[model samples]
Target: MDLCLKLGLLLVIYTAVNASDISVYIPQIAQKITTNVTDRSFVLVQPNCIFTQYPTTNVWVVVALNKSFSTISDSALSTPIPYSSYRNGLYNYYHTLLVSAGKYPCLPSDSTSNKVIQIGSETCKGNQFCNGVLSNNQTYRAKFILLNSSGIFDTTKWSNEIILQQGKSFQGNTGLPSGRSGGMIVLTSILSVLMAFLLLSVIAALIFGGRDLCWKRTMLNQKHSDRNMDFMPRSTYRSRYDNMYLVS
Candidate 1:
């Protein structure tokens, strides 16, 4: 049982590493863990964040379903994807986006724009792009390809994983595979109950402690009043003693 558990943990770690590590494409890795993906109508880049491979001609971003750049099979990579014989092949493609110096320059570096990429199921406008469908609560990734009239000459490693959010359909940003179910609801309820107990304990302590202190102070004040009364003379017996002294 222990060996099985260890192997399970190791497998999870390996998949996570493969999913997020796009070192070559992104250079500096951001420390964010939230899902930064979309299934928007269009995927266009701003002037500063434009995807470019200068001195090369144009840039292509090939997207795949549940795949990293390194994991893509060599047979698929070696085969050109039909339209541009020079373009690199993608075995199981979902979407493609093209950026160029004419429309957008890839020169400027913008980390903020790095996380934004257009994704949808509809076909793109030109031969340079192919459309892919995105379902709710699915994870996807993309890689850059430097293309010219000949197709693709160079490419970058895969980008970080994107967990696409679909309106009310978005599950969460757990980054784990979909269709997982268990005792999550029960666990959350248990945690909430524990928190409530802690808060109540604090309140009860404050009220009870203050009540005891007030009772002690009230008793002390009453005792002092009673002692003062006890020491005072109730009546005087001076009349008889004075008369006897005068006669003597």
Candidate 2:
């Protein structure tokens, strides 16, 4: 009995310890890619983090066109010059405006014109402001950055660059998977305890009930044997007395 209690206590402690080890803040980002049929093209950015509610931060979507996969330097993006205007090689790097939290379909903002450009338009005429036309069959890579309200970047929290091809749609998750919240961990622990207790109760009842049934059956068999012995002796004594009376 004492051993059973010790094991149960150990199980509960093990569960609690394991649950505590789980990380509460696991960063993640979900990206969706789409294309426009017109002359201009850009990747729409959407950002999601496991700890989104805890911080009020701005998300920046950065794109490097036709560049080999390389670490995006802070200096390259943080400069006063807008990314669309800065030319590195054959293609230019572009970044979107500061996206508010929980916003979707973050369109790229043109740095030179200081306006959001239409997705598929060719020229900056009428309602359409041409940012840059993405050539079909070209490849573009993009990433996301999390920054504080004061424009300070969190070096630890950034997404892996995802490559998208022109006229093709891509979707995927970036970064570590999200961990369970405090409430969910607590709920899981409670359920485990309840199930363990229920299992123990069932095992104990089966053992005790089996013992009681065996004892009742043994007592019933003993009573039947005693009654048979008593009846046989009475019949033998009555037969002997009748024989002696007939001989006299």
Candidate 3:
């Protein structure tokens, strides 16, 4: 009779623990990079809540296939809360969101939340640990998963869907330049080539043109020497010889 009572109590305790599952909230806002969005990399604005609520904790920036999670209208995360936490450990380990904390934490009085982080493979650094590379022209949704000493504490809701488009170069976030800078690079190259061609033309003119100019100067000098010979002043001997020849 005592053994049966103990088993019943144990079952009740287990049920109570299991009943309290992880909680989910709407995904926080992710500021898409308006200026320099590229195929392999982008930017995201850190959520405002982390600075005060979970100062010691860090954040993880994650991207997955579009429509994989609940839409904005769903109110909560699309996947099972427990499963999402599980995937948090299993997926993208390299991308821990970066923020300043501790002695130099974000101030509540500050107007903005925090500095932004660039989400490219090359741009990702410090605590980020996921694969660090992103696909080009692939559509994906992004969110922030908060982490504490134990593990994942909570996750924000999914941000709006974004598409990373293809650009000129190899794949992944390996520093492929984009936006205004990309156009500037091409323009600069064209200008460099034209300048080189112009330089060569000037050099050729100097080499051949110098020789032609020298020849013209020499001809003029020769003409002047011939004219001087024809107008030579007559000597006394030459005048006598001329008169004798004329009388004969």
Expressed as tens digits, the lDDT of each residue in 99-206 for candidate 1 is 663444444354555544444645434554455445554455655555565555555566566555565443335553344444676677799999999999999999
Task: Please give the ranking of all candidate structures by TM-score, highest first, separated by commas.
Answer: 3, 1, 2
Question: For residues 1-248, what per-residue lDDT tens digits would candidate 3 score against the true structure?
Answer: 99999999998876544322112333433344464456776666644534343456655555665745443322232221322332344532123344433322444645443445556545333433433545664566667665565665565566677677666443334454644466788899999999999999999999999999999999999999888767876685588689999999
Please state the error at residue 175 of candidate 1 in Å.
Answer: 30
Candidate number that wins on lDDT, 1 or 3? 3
Clashing pairs in 2: none
Best by TM-score: 3
> How many angstroms is residue 23 displaced in model 3 relative to the true structure, after the best TM-score fit?
3.3
Candidate 1 stretches with Cα past 4 Å from truth are 1-23, 27-56, 67-69, 73-75, 78-91, 106-117, 121-128, 149-151, 166-248
Q: What TM-score would each prediction reach against the true structure? A: 0.37, 0.34, 0.47
Task: Judging by lDDT against the true structure, name the best candidate.
Answer: 3
Worst 10 residues of 2 by lDDT: 25-34
TM-score of 2: 0.34
Measured with C-alpha atoms, the lDDT of residue 181 in candidate 2 is 51
